[model samples]
Target chain A: MSLYIKYPKYLTAGESCVVVEFADEIDRGANDAVMNLKKYLLTQKDISIVECLPTYRSLAVYFDPTVVSADEVINAAKSAPELDGEECASSFTEISIPVCYGGEYGPDIANVAEHAGISEEDVIKRHSSKSCHCYMIGFMPGFAYLGGMDESIATPRLTNPRTVINGGSVGIAGKQTGIYPIDSPGGWQLIGRTPLRLFTPEASRPTLIEAGYEVRFVPVAEEEYKKIEAEVAAGTYKPLITEAK
Target chain B: MELIIRKAGMLTSVQDLGRWGYQSSGVPVAGAMDLPALRIGNVMLGNPEGAAALEVTLLGPEIEVKGTGAAVFAGADLGFSVNGKAVGSWRSVVLKDGDVITFKGPRGKGCRGNLCFAGGVYIPPVMNSCSTYIRAKIGGVEGRALKIGDVIKIGEPAALWKKLEGFCLPEDLDPAQDANAPLAIITGLQEDAFTEEGKKLLFESEYTITAESDRMGCRLEGAKIEHTEKGADIVSDAIPLGAVQIPGHGMPIIMLADRQTTGGYTKIGVLTPLSMEALVQKMPGSKVRFRRADVSEGVAEQMRIKEAVRRAKELRLSHVSRTHSEAPKPLFGHFILTVEGKRYEITCEEI
Candidate 1:
């Protein structure tokens, strides 16, 4: 099931950006045609877009060459219209995510269960069984790159990379996973954490996992991770959402 | 509050001309890494080219003021001074209220500059940006770097404040201030994961800039380039803003302005918002080099720096012979004044 191309290539990311790729393979059908050309260039309000991003199979954009250029964002992304990467995959929104796995919040869960010869409870039951796909949020703010893990609990990533790593911890690396929405300096492999507050930046919508959502995780334990870290610092924990297969 | 820091040199912050629609949430557009010397030092002080100034770095911040405002200082040539009197770099000075100012460090090259103030530098902006992204602390001040006494508040100058002082930057609208020019870029990300001799050893050699460069990237060294056999990682993207990348111990960072909004190596080229505002004013053992441009020469060097800052604010608003328009000869008033009570109305003219 991999058709969807609909013109993508365009490169130049320089004098004001462009990139747009769409597929050189990072799967999920080039990130669902990079989230359907980033929701069709965020509905091209007559093209003046100053940001876009959408990674996992390109998107970048970022315009305003004094108004609009980069050949008008490659002629409005080559006359748009490619759509159907799963027809807005049910206008995305799954959420869930709790995770509290392995001792001391995953110290690389016995090296990812001895590199998958499985045991740490079958590596947390094949990493909280399914449901993942985020495909990019970025390295620092509200992190989240996710994307369906479970390649037999794929691991490998810590060849020495840890000067910090804390905020909502969870990890994985190869075949992707993610979560560390804030402490930083990672290298992945570990796995477990999420007391919520996935980056608040003074609240009112700071970021909790957005890039076509769907997360899922849910495991919780250490006294329900200290009662969902005190109902996420007294704001009454929420993270549950739904709507999407 | 009208500026105060008193001596926070070597890393002053509070920038502007950046922080745009949060890179898909990873933030980090930080701002003012010599963005055309903070938009021509807020277009030589008459403010508004993206206000909130003060970048500095490469040792330079002393400031003191506290009342009388106006300042300008653009990219590099730090020597600056006032209560000690030297006042260099593209005109506009005025300061004076306890004056002070300072900044004498590297007087032979460059390395970030700007200052602009006249009214800007106020603060409180965060998401909509007053710049400063000191590794995600957030916008300016509270987000760190400008310590010493901190004060800083400014904002309220342009009442044509003496035609916003002197205004200079006119040396053929200054170009290659040469901290070793060349930058250019735009080569195409992961250019086939490199190797045509690593794109002829990155546009034929010459690197250097590495005291571990800062504002999130620039780290370089020299000949490494090579890749292909598919190594230097790639599954990451959107680094743009002078990208460059290369990792895998083959060096060639670049990024700039606090970078990292996504990056997993192998970029190859990007540079050109006027080569990242002239390679963030060079200096770190300086010596760059990497030309291959295109994207219409980085959109004609960013429309020739927004047409040299809209022709230096229209030649500082039509040259007005170094400001002096005197014409005040009116005096009339129709009394009716009452303060401590909410009932008063009057009209007058006295200039």
Candidate 2:
């Protein structure tokens, strides 16, 4: 399969890492390029390379400068085969996250509805209906930075960030929406919370959602949330994962 | 052998080189703030450079050596003592079972100190690292700082080389006496985001280290750096160690060993490895200035220091003879030594 994608501009992150910029804006194409390059680089298994961190519009390649130079990494990355549309489209895991909205679970649901000029039910429907792309995982471990939030539900972050937001709290800030993997200080407007474990150090794969995966929130009742939370606590609940439709 | 903590002072924790290869998974690479000192202390005891050592911050822990072993203290002179007798820094000292080791508050310019045992601390490795990432509660003892009544096991002692016991790092290798040393910086990922004036201000002005500084980053109180466009926010990208990020409020935060994997603030530059080492040694109110250095220059400086460390290690080894009781036994076919991050194997017969 032949595909033509523009080479990204390489910038130095430090002596040991380089940031490859595909575009200036946070576009889907840029994200795809970043993930594709990261996958391609991993297959090479270069000893000099340390880790590749994929973000919205760029990929940061960390390496040992003592073993390899930035120019060498850039040259290798430039020569990597461009991924075909079908190849890029393949291998996306769709994860269904169970979220309980409104009431104590989401304190800012009414406020979000007011800001978006919609009913509380409409806010939940708009949030859970569309599938969002996991653009990157950062800020905290297993915390997935998602993209593709509906413009109608866009709300501003709290002026004063809360000292602690509970783990699994689903929140939206500006054009982005994500789940908190661990309790942390945050400014995002809370709309809902997931019962599933987004991050656990004990698990073989600590983060449930990886970059480039599709995340869809399924609204559940408060009682169901508690049931699922219990199942998770008992190590019996398996997260629902299916091929992206 | 084991050591029990009698008095856990300030923030004492077990640290090695760092937890690496897990940053992509958002795990902070937590380790000793002063890595050079950690390595020096470990090497002095004939332990691998990456061996887990006790990282004593500001104040120091009072420890009771449960079994006989040799120990070395490196970095800040925290007024180390054994049984009320004063001991010197940067040298290996033989210890007997039931010996009590204690330290006074830092009497020197540096803030952090490292105590390394001959065989290294035998903490279980998490994600392939013995280093403690306290925020995540992973690695080291219960993933937190040492508390009173905690007992840590130490590995088997290296062969006893009496002649090498008193060797110390030369005074020149220690951090410079000036507290306001200029830290070398390489222009970073978001350098273009800052205005020309901002870049000028960074190198021209002096910044005082804030008390909020920790292993995560050094929050500096300095002149506000002007941003040309989005004012300090970014699309959230990987944060390299030593990154000097300017937040919306414009104060620079130099990301360190315990920094989060990625951040949204715009970074103007990153401190050189040596500069990072020097920056960690400074106290809260210490002043700092940034000096521009190219990547090659920074790498070269690191290599130079590594070479110096190699020479220092050789100097200690030269004092050791085959007849020394501490020398590796003939039953052990090989003696493994870590040099400049590479391991070299020497046959016992060859020595």
Candidate 3:
């Protein structure tokens, strides 16, 4: 349960940015290290730091060259203390997302089931049974790249991507599964749709899920989905969140 | 001051330096494609370098002014005119109320142009920027491109506006017009992920800008870049503004202002800011060649461009002072004056 990895490589992204890469592959330990370093850097409040973008196994730090040089940023990143395994273990928030599966909400449910050689009910059960950690948020704003999907349910992305996928649609692609936070063209096999607003510029936080958070899907009936949708539209729906043990 | 969009061209939107300090939350830093152009337009009007301006793409918009103000058109030379009469670009022109400003097909090589008023556009800032990210529906006028009949407000002009009128940067200082200019790139990141042949192909061959190019990215179709064992995919990582990412299909995509915050494609290198400035100006079908430049060289080139912009601004200010010896009487106890290309604050009583 201890997710701790050492980042040994740092490369210059450009004249103004530096990328600290943890590992080449996407693993829990690498993601944990990336998230921990990002948290550490933000706390330092370095005047040179303009923005820091954390991904699966790396963090791209954009800085003002006028304020700090690339060598100085790399040196700061190298000297930063690594998080202990225990600290990484407990720093996660578990949020249950209500998803309406099959029929109209999930057009690709049958496709996913056929690919996985399982029934529609089996697909839903497998998807909701396990919790996943957000590795990073990218592609579109608030779109979390999640880890920890059941291998049996893994399905390849659509050969021809749809022109427009609605926001809050839950999708599965290969070993990865995530939700589209905004309406965009995508190739993921969507198995369900979530009623919660994953991204909204009006909100103070803007994005519902951040990197390193834990996510769980809770299958809801059509009536429940409609009720939650209405509440979300009216700004009264509060998402269920609790600290992960 | 106000202006109504009589004919909204292909795409018109308000932009500034960009929306910064929010990329950590997956927000893209969307801004004008040509940063230098945006700055030059603002500088011509005596406005701040980061002031909001209209980014007119391809065919420019037809606008009718409702209040008197000064305006400057910089970057692309899309046949700009005042009521069908041709107007020179890169110079300040005083507008009269009800004057109709319009533009025809591009007369130059660039794809986008920046039109800035004496006072900046007055749209409320979103995430501390007025730049529009149309894909996400954030910033600018209702987070979308300007349509016909959309009226935009302009901020109050500077006290030195009368003197600053007709100010123009020397013709030699204009942005270079080279459709086939080589873009300087700094190799790093996933450069090793590509095959030696791939790297050679990128530098040796000329790529044509396809019609699929947009604010998000400039997708080029040329000699396919072959990847090594990595095969063009990597653990998703944050993308810099001018990252040259090669997808599985082998075509290189130069990420731009509205690019996603992160991507999984293997990026061979990143273009220098100056190179990106020049690259963005090229329209579809324009040919581009890449040249590897040392990091120090790229940085020095950018510094040189910045200095050029600074010098041009100084020249404009000097022209204003030389042409107008008598400064206007102080208005509202404030005497604003420009000296040595710097704005000075002096009370009317002190003056």
Top TM-score prediction, candidate number:
3
Please list the residue runs of candidate 2 whose C-alpha ends up more than 4 Å from where it truly belongs after superposition: A1-7, A158-161, A243-245, B161-164, B170-181, B312-351
For each candidate, report its DockQ versus the true two-chain complex. Answer: 0.28, 0.58, 0.62
True contacts reproduced, candidate 1: 0.75
Report the TM-score of candidate 1, chain A only: 0.36
Ranking by TM-score: 3, 2, 1
As for candidate 3, its clashing pairs are: none
Docking tier of model 1: it is acceptable
The segments of candidate 3 whose C-alpha lies over 4 angstroms from its true place after superposition are A1-7, A113-119, A158-164, B171-180, B308-351
Instruction: Write model 1 residue lDDT over A1-245, tens digit each, in one string.
Output: 44344436888777688887877657666777777777888898888888888888888888867778888888888787776645566567888888898777888888988988879888887888788888878878878778777888888899999998888889898877888877878788777887887887666568888887878888888898899899989988887888754
lDDT per residue (tens digit) for residues B1-351 in model 3: 899999999999999989887776688999999887788778777788889999999899999999888888888778778888777578778888999999877876677878888889999988788999998899999999999999999998765565566687777667654556699889999898888988999999999999999999999999998999868778788899999999988998999999989888999889988888888988888889999976676566556666667876787566544532386643433457999999998632212
Candidate 2, position B105, lDDT: 74
Residues A10-92, candidate 2, lDDT per residue (tens digit)?
88866878888887667787789898899888888664688898888889888878778888999888877876767667668
Residue lDDT tens for model 1, B1-351: 388887799788888987888788888787888776667667666678899888888788887887787787787778887887777777787776888888777676676677887778888787788888878788888888897888988888654445455667788776434555687787876778887987888888998888988899889898988888988987888887778888888878888888988888888778877667667777778777888877787777778888888888777655422423386533333346778886675534332
TM-score of each: 0.36, 0.89, 0.90
Clashes (N, CA, C under 3 Å) per candidate = 0, 3, 0
